[model samples]
Target: MNHPLTDVTRTLGGIAYGGDYNPEQWPREVWREDVRLMREAGVNLVTVGVFSWSRIQPRPGTYDWSLLDEVLDLLHAHGIAVDLATATAAPPPWFTRQHPDARPVTASGTRLAHGSRQVFCPSSPAYAEAADALVTALAARYGDHPALVVWHVHNEWGNHNALCYCDTSADAFRSWLRERYKNLDALNDVWGTDFWSQRYGDWEEIDPPRDTTAFRNPGQELDYHRFCSDALLTRHRAETTILRRIAPRVPITTNVMGTLEKKVDGYAFAAECDLVSVDHYLPAADPDGHIDLALNADLARGMARGRPWLLMEHSTSAVNWQPVNVAKQPGEMRRNSLAHLARGADGLMFFQWRQSRVGAEKWHSAMLPHAGTEGRVWKEAKALGAELAALREVTGSRVHGDVAMLFDWHTWWALELQARPSDQTRYLDAVRDWYEALWTLNITCDLVPPDADLTGYRAVVAPSLYLLSDHDADNLSRYVDQGGHLAVGCFSGVVDEYDRVHLGGNPGALREVLGLVADEYLPLRTQDHALLEDGTRVRQWVERVETRGCTPVLRFADTTDGGPAHGGPAVTRHSFGRGTAWYTATRLPVTALREVLRTLCAQAGAHPVVDAPPGLEAVRRTGEEHAYLFLINHTLDTAHVSVTGVGVAGAEITDGRVVVPPGDVVVVREDLTIAPA
Candidate 1:
């Protein structure tokens, strides 16, 4: 792989062992001891200068790279790779005092007073100028250094961000509207904004929708979120452009917080970077790791569209940020790390290789704790290190996929922007519903963005769509009509991006075409589940509708004598256009999802990637010479994995069964000489 990051990757080889390194927060002599301990733990990469902006340039027109210079220089001499940072996490106190507009405003109407990093307003010229200047200075000074492998733009950009509605942002918002609408006429249609006598006569009348600032138009508020995203992107580009000028080939990236709900457009931002990266932190007590870990990894993996990325920050144990902090049990850390890797991550990394002596993260997990490497954390980290050191040769091993779930930003934005009938209707949950279903079927599915073409994929699942452009709808219709298998979930195709429901029926444009009739309905009450006339309870809340002409495999069973069934037409199938469409009226249980997905799987004729037991996960990745199957037993009990795709030489599981222990991993490889079981 002749990647622009090849040289950096050479140094970033095997496993990226080191994590956050803030020598500025420690004594100089401690740096030596830290390095000694890091070497003992096989630590190689040091992410330094994350929050050193205040120290780097204490004032405008001043530079103090001496400390960072020493840090980077020492790491270079020691053969440790350095992910040199922009040191722009925080604007110095003097810069903020001099240019108060440099601060950001929250969605709530308030001017932010900066006391923390990540408070700088992306819309402010002062902040942009300062950030750009700092990046330029750092890259220019150390671009060619052997130790500098990656450019970390800034520390977590969307972590409890500050409010900043200075004059600059307001002016920029108007300008943004000018470019988007060209005139107010086109904007009014998308927003239907004049219904409340809220028509804008000029661009100057436009402003960000702050919570305290009067009116609340869905279109305006949503666009404001989009505007904020674009503004931040503009600022991010400013710094990346500087890095491009200096280290044109060095991979540039930033660690995005897992499952970030901020207004920032990470999907677009990923396109600008050479490599995508994210921090991972999921609580041990989470009923399921999907919300905090699995789904986050899937989203990040999807952000890059199957491209390999770095797990920028994750706790080796519990994180202080979660409501309840719980450490990873005996082998839980490795299991969790492998979980992300199975989702297409090429590298695994964590936050704070060394423990922070103070701050909110002081109690968080670390490899070498304040108690030192002799402890349990260090032992676990060392084991992880050994796995990577031994498996270095498979650095670029890829996860092969022919199945993908269509994920979209437009859909995410549109769906979230809509005020749905139920409060539980959400973009992430909708996605999770589909994912949890597929994962249960022992099927490993890739998350794909709508911008990607559907080629060679057996099936594409799009659920709770709630939004789609006319062009996109046509594109989808064509895919299915052309002998392709597609599965869609509830509440889809109901509205356009403007939050206005398409006329005719619940699923609007896709209704008749998908062979389904979703008429306006009788919603079920809370604590009650939908029931099919067959007497089976539909998974979650649902709507009752009339299904005529379509094959109603199951009908809602109304318990109250005179009432229309409180649930949906349990399962309905119909022929639309040139393909077959099946719709489930209500959400399904995990078991039901798997059963339905299995049927869909057989319909699509796709095969499971592994023989994983319940509570375990399995995925296979194939390359030119071999296919690697990762069997991760997420359960505490040992599980059996059946053999698949094998022959004489290197067929370890050919005898039919392989026992994988609790929280253990099995990396079985084949020469492609085996059958596709």
Candidate 2:
């Protein structure tokens, strides 16, 4: 089956560069000025009418399109395209007043108010009907408008109102379970309800794993997560159906929050979008925030199945929500934008165009700050816009990585459940450690689902994946058996899809393929550290391992403490049918892990794009005719690089060596045409 492609260049003719334009926020007189500034800044695209539900439909059944029509006309006249929004993200006050049940109810049974955004229940009929009507009206009115290029669906689905544990949701859950399990006996068996005499005789006994005295059943909680993710996706599909029926030519997309979003399955949600788009922000306090940015950009590209994605929303400076919204220093924003572009983002945008003066996000940074055109942010935004325009040839290019990291939403949810081995075992931290090592080595990585095709990748890494389905386990085993390299981290393959223990041994389904059997879990205390025979430090967790058909590469150092794991295998290697499988029973420090990965990558035939200096980020995006090498110098001191390519104008490239100044980006395009030797 062929999916509709999201081609932004078809309409914009270049890389999409702009932010969210909210004309309704300002007086009508200021609208003209917004367009003039946008033209001067080289903004070719802007998202319009995202949160304009109340303004568009003042009363229950009335709609006023005068404001929207005028806004679109002005943008089109100024040569700017629109990513018109459906305006159903936030319901108006009148909607909540008429249908109070539409308000999302908390797990504690408190129905939230409508003062904030995304306040509607996912399963409420009233909310669905209202949203559907609004989407239909917008699609019908502006389906053929010249200014419109893409139909922006609801803003950030599952960000705030991901789950609603109301009676309506309970009924929906029961129905969803019925379609999934088909009978009470099947549901009971999968949920392992025979434990603690909690077997259910009927569907009525089942409910969401809502507030409980003790730890709720892990199986029940896992299924409930699946239900919630599907519920929100159902809403997105509803709006998509209306849009495709009315305006099938215009591609539809809703901005997705990157790794920060845990409530919804991002991979499943992305499958519904014509174009995969993500909204990412830097951690204000983290000095190495650029590393996280690269991680998410690669994840977004993976979500798009290696296609170029859009950077829908990021801050030009500080955000308002954090405890301390630290601002981006000079040249930081430019470096951040190009880093994303280098990683495979075709369109770059921000949270907003103009800063707000009277809202919850008044302090949030924007392209046009509160200080207006005189601010540093505005000047940088213009320069970045022009740079994006010059790099339009990169729009359809794709980022290629020899390494793939297995990331699963269900595994993340189940791994963090109560009554686990260690509260210190965080899914994000474990995954980041592996990605950071790859990033430091300048080796590109793609965060892929467990079921993704592994033949194309040279090496695959699965870290802290506590839950594993039988099908996915078979997939990984098959990949390894077919001469592919694989590395399984600690606590992986412990449970089935229902969160039930695999019963025979630890890492149940993968034991045979991995050639190892884990006996007992040894979760370390907060301050405890274990030493490896190779003088490497292991922290957080370890396990008692008994090698089945493998060789121990690294063993625990001998100790006088008389611990059960005094000299056990800390890491092992197994040759499984023409390929190798590596397993780690303990968490290696990031620096040590980097060396381990370096060896594994070398053995697996995976190499970095370039040998970059420390603190300098390097990545490559390849197309049919050219390959772009992006060298971003995050360090303070100027550095020189050796690469043969044509540099963008103004870049300091001479002969084989290129000079990169401190805190800047340089894109070197390598022509694919080979000269006769």
Candidate 3:
């Protein structure tokens, strides 16, 4: 909620650099060596006790603080900050032995054995009561610890206990429903439970929404996903409440896995966190991985708004979890990390300070990789740290940009409710498809939520807009009617907040302004494309609609199954008040799609930061002192870049617009004092 400043003021910088380091995981003598190496590498902070529930508690209440106390004192003595953990994610074996109901039940109805983290059920009052007591004890114990900057609540929640459906969960779900609907009648009407001859006169009659018979409703499945997210948030809120009473100023956060679908609701959780942090892991040559990373960073940046985000954890070399544990090439880590910085990042830390000796993640790479500090990975870490330390100001200073992309959740929820075409058209995929297109153009943009003001934007692309509030609809209408350039893909403006489809045809809410009707849709599964009057589409068949009062800019290539048309307006524009609204009837391939976005952006008065060579990537960061341009080539082959001077007032820092060799990262900050001539 901090808004734009969070992105700029915070800067793509790191204050407390380092990751989780637990000397307790190793021998006493090694702790000294670890501290020495940390100082040598310019490590500023370390996160400790993430999965140490058993370590801290030992045996249910015995309280062995000897090792933990020493570790904390040791790290603090070395001038290293710490992100102290609550250690409540994993329960002591004795607690579960005494209370069996505390075990987490999975979606497939299997019980999670003890020893796994996040095995405690969120709905269990006993579990909450235990977790609350432990968290309070930890906060009260370390409430004034100087080395600690924040409290890391429950580790990576929703991994194990995500879809809990135990008795406690069932009861909690019923309570949550009562609070949400206030009564059973409303719930029945919204869920359409009446149609199945299943009328719940009382709340207890409703069980968890699951497949009891052969018929599996996707709507119910989607709601269950949403409910689970809410449930985890409820737990986070409860735990953070207790901690807040004692340590009010210290931020409370958890390392969130980027784009977790059926787990914690990160957007909602944003309300609780003082600063948002996320885990980032990208594949070496993943076809969609790069774009996926962009979406993830944009999503996290959106959550943080005007504040800087934390790169909580990423593989230094290669993570052991993926199907293939590919090592990061010589420059991949620096390149990818800088890419994260270009977006918006405040801090960088890995999962563990030292690799785990035991557990599922024992093999994950760390600063102190399995090869000690003598290997290439550790050497790179040292170099990265040095670069950050020397360039701290630019690293911390804010970047300025005005344009923002309009991102909406209701639209995401409503897209799946599309009555036609096919039920498989996903909302995020549609949004990602559009976002990736824009990204390829090297244009600077912010991924803003729907509620954000659209007036500042020159162009706004809202893909797969499913549900819109009356006010939101009005805002977009005026934005378009008043000279703003707007673009949205198919499956937009179909529903309201109650998850009800708009009564009219497709885009029922904005049909008047958009000036089009999509009576039929052609689902194209192939990556082939076709051009119409307006623009060409990249994915599957296009929307076949009648150009009512507006104009038909394009047509379909062919018809399907006796349909009159196969394609309708692969792209179209309609003037409202003084502006325009554009709709894309078909999914556009990334290359063609960026061309479309580039055209719209040009119309909106926003141009690419700079043209680059084939493999080179360009991103611009504007500051009061000077504007910084980051050019990086992630590919193996060298790429050439062409550039006119970046608009800077002072000393022209141009090394000639030339080819940036492969795997090269170029940083140029204009010296504003020099005369333009």
Candidate 4:
């Protein structure tokens, strides 16, 4: 299937190598220099009007498009394209003052102030009308501009005020429940409201899960999250409808904060966009953060269904938000950009084109820093643009993965609720632990939703899946029965969609396929650890399992009380149909988990593109005519990797045994060969 932005000539022409450009913040004289410097840096695209709502529409039903018109015309004259934004990210102060109900209210009943962005209540009818008007005006004015290529809808949704408990939201929540349940009786039954006299007598009695003395109903909280996601999506769809009508040829999208922010569902939002775009910010202090960044990129690619997506926003150096803002070390910026391209990003862009002299994010890095072209950041930025220009052949390629990892927003929300088996059970940490192990083996993976098609993957890993719907559970069983390897972590398959415990056994729905039924949970306190059969210690949580027809992969060697669990199975493997299912009863240490994953991949007939050392990543992107291999080294030490599977004649191999220095990238291309039978 071809994406809306698949036409390379219309889209960036090569790799989009620019970022957010705020020409309105500077004087008209400065705008000319900005364009001149953009050419020197090889910038081809810039995102404009992201936060200019107050400037463009200062009053009710009034707009001044002179500034935007000058900006777009200037960019076009300099051969730069524009990703025009609707500028509806934040409402103007006049609108909020006129309609105070548009301000979002916290769960504690305090209305959020209007100074920050995204302060409007999603359910407010007045806010919707004003937002639609702004988008309509922008689209109608700039729809036929020669520079306009893509339409950027509102900025990051649910970034600040994800959930609101105002009366407007309460009414909308009730209406949503009515559509879902159709009656108060069904709602009461599904929420399991009988325990605390919380059964609703009417739809009006239902409220957004607000601040309370005790824990609120898990089911209700989960539904509130869903409602908030849908509410924002409704606003997006409204704006998209106007853009499609006015500029039917341009693709519409909104930048998503993937894995960085948890309030929005990426898959649901991606479905609404003509193309998926993500913003990723790596931690400055953590040396191992590149792995997490890779995970986020993979998630964004999966949201786009393996189609090429855009890297919307990333800092050129230190950001102002963290406690200690450390600048990017030498060579880190280039390696980071290539990593995203290797994963599946079609374009590379940063947060800002020029540094802001006054603002909350004044210190945030930009393509052109305050120090100008003399700085290291500017040098690196120019060098990267040149490299991307040389590698334009990589455009319109796709990356394929042999392994799939489950990433569900519902599971993340339900697992991290107020109550749980252990306080140390973090959903993302568990998923990353498994992903880090796979990365260590140089394997590529795709982050998939539970209900996504499983036929493409040879093995699937699910970690901390606390909430499972009936459809998802049945889908997993069928995948395993049809000869696919399945690996699950502890605290999985424990509850249904309504947050009610599966009563028959722990991991209730998957017990038959896993060949083990857990009877009770054994949570470890801080500083506590238990010994596994391999002499590696497991911590945080453990479960007591009784195998039905499974082979013990590892057993518990030590227990808290020296009880029945001391000799029980800590990990089990079962044969289901022509496939195998493996289960871990606790979180294994990193070294041990890596060993186990290596064995699992071998058993599943899954191999990496190359056998490289730790901190070196290998990924393959293939086109119909040729294939490219990307080897990136994240560590400070030099890496020497041997390449394989490229023996076809006339293949252009950069280096058979590539020598990648610290924080560097190596790309190798091979021509496709036709096999004769």
Model 3 TM-score on a 0 to 1 scale: 0.90
Q: Which candidate leads in lDDT?
A: 2
- All models: lDDT? 0.72, 0.89, 0.70, 0.87
Q: Which stretches of candidate 2 lie over 4 Å from their true place?
A: 1-6, 561-564, 675-677
Error of 3 at 531 (Å): 7.4
Write the residue-wise lDDT of candidate 2 on 356-460 in tens digits: 988898899999999999999999999998888788887777899999999889999999888899989989888888889899999998999999999999999
TM-score of each: 0.93, 0.98, 0.90, 0.97
- Residue pairs clashing in model 1 are 104-163, 104-164, 105-163, 105-164, 106-163, 106-164, 533-555
List RMSD in Å for every model shown.
Answer: 2.9, 1.5, 3.9, 2.2
The digit string of per-residue lDDT tens for model 4 on 534-618 reads 6777778888899999898988885554233677888889999888899988888778777777788899988987877878898
Per TM-score, the best of the predicted structures is 2
Clash list (residue pairs), candidate 4: none
Q: How many backbone clashes does every candidate have? A: 7, 0, 22, 0
The candidate with the higher TM-score, 2 or 3, is 2
> Candidates 2 and 4: which is better by TM-score?
2
Q: Judged by lDDT relative to the true structure, which candidate is superior, 1 or 3?
A: 1
